[model samples]
Target: MSDVNTTRASAPQWRDLRETVQRNCDIADARYAGNDTLCTYLLKMREFYRWERGLPYSMALDRREVGDWVVAREQHWEGLEAQDLDALTLGERRFDPFDHEAVNQHLSPHGLVYGAGYGRGARPLFFLGSLIKLEDYEGYRIYVVGQEMARDLSSPPAMSRGERIFVRRESIRRMVFEMIEAWQMRGAPAVDSLGRALRAYGHDPGNDESLERMVDAEVESAVWHEVGEVLAGRLLGPEWQERMMTVAGSRAERVMRAVRDHLADCLATLPALLDDAPEGALHFYFANLGGMRALLFPQLREAYEGWVKGGTLEELKRLIAPAREHWLTVAERLLREPPETWPVSDEALPSLCPDFSGRRLG
Candidate 1:
C-alpha cells in the first residue's frame, strides 16, 4: 500500500491537519446539534464518543462514563458554537477548508484524505483520514479513506462535491455495525428487513467478525449510491442546487432530498446492486430506507416484497423503470414554483407530484 500512504516522517503535518479538521467539525456540531431530537442527539453522541475513544464494537459502553462524556462534550460545543471555520495551514501553504480538491493535491502525497462538504440541513462537515484507495470513476476522482483522525457527529459514509467522491470505509463500518447493534438491541424481530438481510449473509451480528465481513461487502453498496448521485446530478441539472437553497433548513428541503435520492437509486444504485450485488445487499438497502424516502415511494417497498415472494427481480426492475422519469417530473414541477410558495406542506405533495405506483406509471 505504498501508493495508499507515503507517510514517511509526516507526523508534524498530520497533527496540523487533524487540528484543523477537528476544530471545523466542532464548530459545525455546536451550531447544529440542537436541531436533532433528544434521542437522535444522544445516539449520535454515543457513536461520536466511541470513535473519539477508539472503542471496539464488541466492548460494552459504560453508561455512566458515556453520560459524563456527553455532558462535557456539550459544554465544549457551547464554547465553539460562535467560532468561525478556519483554513488549513500546511508548512508554508494555506487552503480554504471547503476547497477539498486543491487541499487534496497537497495532502495526498502525505497520505492524507481530507473531506469538507455540507450535509443535511446544509451543515458543514469536515474530516481528515489516511487515504486507503484512490481511483478514477467516470471522470470523477474517488478517494476512499480509513482511520479518520477527525470527524463530526454524523460521519456520513460518502459525500460528493463537484465531481469528487469521498468514501469512508471506517465510517461505513461503524454505521453498518450500528445498524446491526440496533437490530440486536431490539431482539432482531423477523419482520425487520435487516434481520432478513443478515440471515441471507449468514451473518451473526453479535459477532464482530461477521459484522466486518458485511462491512466489506457493503462498502461497494455505498460507492454505488454515490455514483448514482453523480448520475442524478447530471439529470437534475445545476439548477437543483438553486432549488435546494430555496427550501434549505425546512421540511420541504427534506422532501427535495428524498425525491432526488429515489431518482438516483432508480437510475443507478438498485440497477447495479440487482445485477451483481449479493442478495443481502438489496435487503440491506430497503432496511436502511426510511424518513422522507420511504414515504415518497411506498410502492418500491411493495415491489421489494413482490421480488422476495415471487423469486424474480422483474417486479423491482419494472418499478425502477419509471422511477427516474417520475421523480424528475416531480422535481421539475417543484422547481417551477416561485421560491415564495414554500414552506411546502403535505398539501403540496399532491399538488406538485401525485402519489403514483409502478402500475400507474406503466
Candidate 2:
C-alpha cells in the first residue's frame, strides 16, 4: 500500500492510542492542577481551554465563556482524580506508560511518538504526537514529535527520560507565543535581554508566522538543554535522584533543581548557544533566567551584563566550562549527606550551594 493509504488503514488503531494517552493526561491534570496559585491556575486553564477548542492565536476569547469552561473542566477533573493511569495497548499487547523506550519501539514504525515523564512537584506528564523525525545525539534517542495528538495540562516543551529526548514542537510554538504575549501585556520589563531577543527574531506581537519561526529556532535551544540534562544526570549519578525525591516539593528541592539546571546549561546549553544561536537566543536564555537559578549564580548574571556592555560573547563563552565544573561540584556536595540529615530551615537551602558573589542570594 502507498504510505498515505497505509496510514489511512491504521487511523482507527491510532485513534485508540491517542484516546489512551489523553485519558491518562486528564488523570494527571485532575490530580495536580491545584498545585499552582489561583491566578496561575486560571491562566493555565484559560490556555488549556484554548488548546482544547483549537482557537486561533488572534481570536479574542470571551471571558465569561472561558470562566465557565474552567468550572466545567474542574468538575471533569474532580471525577478523574482518583483514577490510575492506564497501561497503553497496541493491538492486544499492553505496555507500561513509563517504559517509553519499549512503547516507542512499537509506535515509531507507525509514525507515532509517545512520552511519559515527571515535572515540577513530581507530577506525571504524558503526550503522544506524530513522529516528525528521529536522530541520535550522543547515544541518546531524540524523538521529535509534531502536532501533538494528546497532551496534559502542564505541557513542557521538551524533556529527557533516561536516554531518550522528546521535543514537542507544538508545545514550543504555543509556549513561544505565550512568552511574547506575556511580555507584550506588561512591556516585559527586562527589555535589554528579552526584548532584544524578540527583536532579533523579528517577533511582531500577535504575528503567528513570527511565532512559528521563533518556535523553529528554539527547538535547538530546547534540545541542547535536555541533552545537558542527560549529561548532568550522568555526572550526579542515581543518588541525585534519591536526593531530589527526598526533598521534592520543598524549598530545598528548588535549590537542587537549580544547581543541576545550571550544571546542565553550562555543560551543554551555554556553549552551543553562544557559538551557534542568534544573539537573541542567548539574551532570552538570560532574560527568562531568574528564580533560584539567578540567585545561585550571580556571577553568571554579572558575566551576562559584561557581555551586554562589551558587545562581545567572549566573556560569556569563557564561563561555560568552569561553570559546568562549579555546578557539578555543588551538586555532589548537596548529595554528600542524606536528606534526613539536612538542615530544617528553608532559609538554609540557599547556603547549600556556595554564593555566586555575595554571602547568599537565592
Candidate 3:
C-alpha cells in the first residue's frame, strides 16, 4: 500500500467557544420571555446545528394568524370606530416584521403606541405578531426588530436580538466541543463512548446495538419526518397535515422505513474508502468535519477553487485524494454512530465502550 503523508498541524481546540455560545443561548432564553421576535431569533441561533443540517424551520405562527386569533379574543376588539377598524386591519398586516407601513398605520390600535419609531432608512419593518401560531386558536403576541433597525437603534454596544442569538449559538457550539474534548481525554474510543458520555450528562443512550446506530437512526428519523412534512405541505397545501394523515397515514411508516434502509446501504460502503487512510486520520476527520462539502463535493465549485488557488498540478492532485478520503471517513463514522450520540443534551446516555479504542485524529 502507498503511504500518503496526511499530517496536519492542530490548531486551538473549539471547546471554549462552544461553551460560550451555549451560555449565551441560555441567557437569551431567560431574558426575552414574552418577546416573540427576540425569542424566535434566540431559539434559531441556539438550534444552529438543526438549521445548518437543513432541518425543518421550527414551526411557529405568523402575525396575520395571531391577529386573527386576537380578533376571536376580546370579541375582535369590539365596538371600535372606522379608524379603529382600519387600525386593526393595519395591525394585522404589520405583524409580519417586513410590513413596516402597515404596522405604523395601525400602531395605536395594536396597542404599540410606546415608541413606534420610523423604520431605519427607506426599508420597511414590522414587528413579528407572535412567535407561535395555530389555526383557529388564539396565541400570545411577540414582537421582533429587523436587522436594519437593530443596527440603527443600537447605542454603544447594546446587544441586538441577532447579537444575543449569535452569542447563544456560539455557546451551543462550545458545549459540543467540550463534550468531544471529554471523549478525547478519556482516550478516544471507537466503541460507543459517546453514548456513555451522554448518559453521564443525563441523556438517554437509547436501545441500539452501537452508539453509531442510535445516531444514524435519530438523524434518519428527523430527516425523513421533516421531509414528509415538507412533502405533505407542498402536496396538500394549507391542509397538508390533515391531508397527509388522510392519504398516507400508515404508509408514511413504510416510506420512511424504505428511505432509512436506502440510507443504510449508502452508509455501508463508506468504510471501505477509508482503507487507504494514513492510520488515525479517519477518526479525526469523521469527528470534526461538517457541511455539504463533506457530502457533495462534486457539485460544489468551491472545491474546484482549491485547484485554482494552488500552483503545480501535482500539489493540487495530492490535496484532493486526502480531502476526499477524510470526508469519506466522516460519512462512514456518521453512518456507524447512533443518532442519540449526536445531540448535546443534559440527559446523555452511557458509552458502549468500557475501554476506549482508536487513536485521535489531528
Candidate 4:
C-alpha cells in the first residue's frame, strides 16, 4: 500500500505478498469466517495479477475447509458496504480489502481497481478454494469475475460514471517505438523545419493535458522518454545523451526548451490522432493535420501501396513529399486565417480528415 508510481520499476515481491496474504487471511478467518467476502475478493484479484504476469498463484491454504465453512454458514452471511468495510473492529489497525477507501488509496497508483465497478449488496458466494490452477490467458477469463464485483460497488444512476479508456500496454508501446523510429529516419533538418512550422502555426509546447488523458502511466512514460530522445538528437547533435545525463543549469534548460518546441511540430505533422488535444492551440493544428491527411494519404495511398505490400521504406519519401506539402499548405492557412471551429462539419471534416469516415490512419 505504498506509492505504486515510486516503485513501478519493481513488481511486488511474491514472498512478501504471500506472507501478508496469509497473515490477513488467518485474522479474517478467525473472526469473519464464512462472511469473509472481502478477503476472498482480494485473494482472487491478487491471483489475477499473477496470472497476467505468468506467475504461480499457489498459496498455503486449505480451500476445501474454507468452502465447507461458507456453505454451512450461508444463511448468516452479510455482504459489506463501503463504510462497513472501512471500519476497524478487532483493535488490530490493519489493512482490509473490505475497506474500499484503503484499497483504492493503494491501488489507484497502479491502475488497479476495486469497489468502483459494482453496486452494494451484490456479493456472490465466491469461495477461492476452487481455483487451484489458472490456465494460460486466465487473466482474461477472470476479468469478467472482477467486473461483476466492480458492478456491485457502482454508484447510483444519478451519479455519472466517468469515461474510461483502456489501451493494451503492448500496443501503445509499439506505437511509441514506431513513432520514434519514423521521426528519426526523417532526418534532423526536416524535423527542425517541422518544428519551425509548429511555432509559425502557433503551436504551444507547454501544454501537456493530452498526456494526463492517456490511460496507462507506462505509455506516458515511454512517450516522454522517446520524444525526449528524438528531440535531444536534433537539438544537441550526436553527443545528446552525454549532454542530457551530465549537464545541468542553463544548458539543460536550453536543450529541453528546444525539444519541447520541436515536439510541438512533430506531433502536428503526424496524422491527427484520435485524442490529440483537448482545447486551445493544439486543437486546430491537430484538426488541420487530420484534414491534410484526409486530403493526402488517400491520393498517396496507391503510390505507397507497393511499399506496404513489399514492406520497404525505400519509396516512403516519395509518398511523404506530397503529404508534407499538403500539411504545410494547411499549416500556412492556419497561421494566416484561423478557423472558427475544428473538425468542421461532416461535409467539411474531409478537409481535415480525408478518411474521416474510415477513421483509420493507415
Candidate 5:
C-alpha cells in the first residue's frame, strides 16, 4: 500500500482537487439536498473516487479536470426543465445510453451520471452501480462507479428503480428486507425473470444470501419441471391423452403383457389339435385343459360349453380348436399394437372372442 502524506501536501494541484470536490459536495448538499439530480452526480463521483484510489498515482487524476468532469455531468442532468418532459416521456421508445437525448431525464433518475477519460480514450466509461448511505452525512448519498465495456452496444446498460436512490444506512437495511419480502410474494415465473435481470446487472445481495439461494432453487425447479413435461410428451407421443391417462396406460401395459404371455405359453404346450388321434386322446386333452379352466373368463367358457354340451366328440374338437385360435390371434395382435391401441371388450362374452381370458374381461 502507498503511504499517506504525513502532513498536508505542498502541491497546489492536489490541494486544488481536494478543494474542488469538497466545495462541490458542499454546494450540492445545500442546493440539491433533496433534489435528485445533484444527489445522483455526487453519488457517482463518490464511487468514481473510491475506485480511483486503487489506481497507480500516475494513472489516477488529481487535477482540475476531474472536478470539471463532475460539474459537467451534474449540469447535463440539471439542464432538463419541465418543457423538456416530452423527450423524457419515452412512451414506447427503448432506452439507448449513447443516444444522449433518449436518456436525458432518466440518467439521473436511474442513478447514473456520465464521466469521460479514465487513463485513456479507449477505456469505456463507468456507471455507478452501487448505492452509498452516509450515516451522519445527512445531505448526500454516495454512488460508486463500476466499469462496463462499450466495445459493442446493442442496448443500454441495465437500470432500475432499486438503483436510483441512495438511502440512510437504516433505510437501506429496510429496503433490502422489503425487496426480499416482495420477491417472496411473487410466483416462481416472475421470480425467475427477475433473477435473470438481477444476474445480468451483477447485483449481489451479500448479507441476503438465503434470499438469492431460494430464488435460484425455485427457478431451477421450474426449469426442470418444464423439461420433464416436454420429454414425457415427446416420448409418450399421441398415446399420451393426459397425465392421468398416461398413468392408467402404464398399468394396462403390465396387464396386457401378462395376458399375452399366458396365452402364448398355453399355445406352445399344445401338441397338435388337428384330426390325428392319439391313444387316450380325451385324457390327454383334459390334462392340458384343467389349468386353462382357471384362466378363461367364466362367462366365455360357459358360452362355449353351452354350444358343445351333449354334442359329438367331433363337435367339441371343432369348438375348442377355434376358441384356442381366437385367443392366440388376440394375444399376437395385442403384442403388435401399442398399449393405448390394444382393444378392450365391452361385452363379457362376445361371439367372436369365445376364449377371452379372466385377465381383463372388460
Candidate 6:
C-alpha cells in the first residue's frame, strides 16, 4: 500500500482516540476545580504536548504505539511530580488505573502485556494518567488532526498545522484581527499615552508612523473605509450612497478632532499641584495625575505611580525629568523617523524617552 493509503486506513481509527483524550481532559478539569493553579498548569502542559506531538494515548497496546505513548506519559508524570500537590484531594483513594501484571497476562500474542499499576511495566502508564486530562481536549484535537494531516503530506509539511486548522484565508485574517483587538483592549491606556505624548509636541497622533507600523496595509485600508462610513452616518444622517462618496480626508480629520476633544475633557479633571507643594500634597496630586496617565498608558502606570508615592514632588520630578525630555525627542522625531527604524514593528515601544536622529521643529 502507498503511504497515502496507509494514512487513510489509520484515519478512521484516530477518531476514537481523539474522543478518549477529550473525555479524559473533561475528567481532569472536574477533579481540579478548586486547585486551579495546578489544574491550569497541567492543562497547558497537556495542550503543549498535544500540539507538539500528537495524542499521548493509543487505540491498541501494540508495542510501537504503546511504547511511544508510555514515554510521553512518563515525561508528563515527571513534570507533575516536580509540582506541589499537597493541597489536592484524590478523595481518600489514590487511584491506580494502569496495572502491569493484569495487562501482561491478558495480552494478545502480538500485544505487549504491561503490568497493571503494581509492577515496573505498569509504572509508566500509572504516571501518564496522573497528568493527562481532557479539559483542553479541543486544542488536542486540533493538534492531532493538524499533525496527522501534515505528516501524511511530507516529512515536514509546507504549511503548518495552525494554518490548516485555521483553513480559509478569511478565517486566518479574522483570527489575526481578533488577536489585534484583544491586544489593543489590554494595552489601550499605553497606546493612548503614546498618542498624547506625540500630540503634546505638535505631532499629528492620527498620522503616527508607529501606529501605521502596528497595522498591516490591508487591515488599515479596511479600518479607514469602515471609519469613513461610520463618520458619514453621523454627519450626513446615514444615506448609503452619500456615505460612500464622502472624502476619506474629511472622516480622518473628524476622528483627530474627536480625539483631541476627549483629551481636553480628561485634562479638565486634573487637580492643581506645584513643584513647591509638601510631600503629602504632592503625593496626592501625583496619584491623581497618574490615574489620568493610567487611562492612556497602562503599562507604565504602576511604575509612574510608584515614583510619585516614593518621595517629594521635587525629587520625583527630578527623577522623571530625563524621561520627559526623552519623550519630547521621540515625539519630535516621529514625523521624520524612517518607517523601518520604528520599534513598533516588533510590537514594542521604547521603554524610556529616546533621542531622534534629526530635529524637525514642526
lDDT top scorer: 1
Best by TM-score: 1
Tens digits of per-residue lDDT, candidate 4, 43-133, equal 4333333333334222333466545544543332232211123222222345554443454344444334332221122221111111111
Query: Residue-wise lDDT of candidate 2 within 1-362, one digit each (tens)?
Result: 01211132266768888898999999999999899898888878888888889887788899999989988988888889999899999878899888888898887787788899888888899998888768885688777778777899899899998778888988887777777778778867655677878888887775677777778778878888989998988888878877787677877787788888899998889888888788778877877799888877777888788877865777677667666767888788788876666643546655654444532221
lDDT of candidate 5 vs native?
A: 0.33
Off by over 4 Å in 2: 1-10, 188-190, 340-362
TM-score of each: 0.93, 0.91, 0.19, 0.23, 0.19, 0.19
Scored against the true structure, residue 267 in model 3 reaches a CA lDDT of: 33
Evaluated against the true structure, the overall lDDT of model 1 is: 0.82
Q: Candidate 1 — worst ten consecutive residues by lDDT sum?
A: 1-10
Per residue, candidate 3 scores C-alpha lDDT tens digits across 42-131 of 333433333323333223435564445444422422322112101222312314332333443443233221112111121111122111
Give the runs in model 6 whose Cα sits over 4 Å from its true position: 1-310, 339-341, 351-362
After aligning candidate 5 to the native by TM-score, how far in Å is the CA of 338 from where it should be? 3.6
Clashing pairs in 2: none
**Residue 173 miss distance in model 5 (angstroms):** 86
lDDT of each: 0.82, 0.80, 0.28, 0.31, 0.33, 0.28
Candidate 6 residue 81 Cα shift, in angstroms, is 65
Task: For model 5, name the residue pairs that clash.
Answer: 43-143, 47-144
Residue 143's lDDT in candidate 5: 26
* Candidate 4 to truth, TM: 0.23
What is the total number of backbone clashes in candidate 3? 39
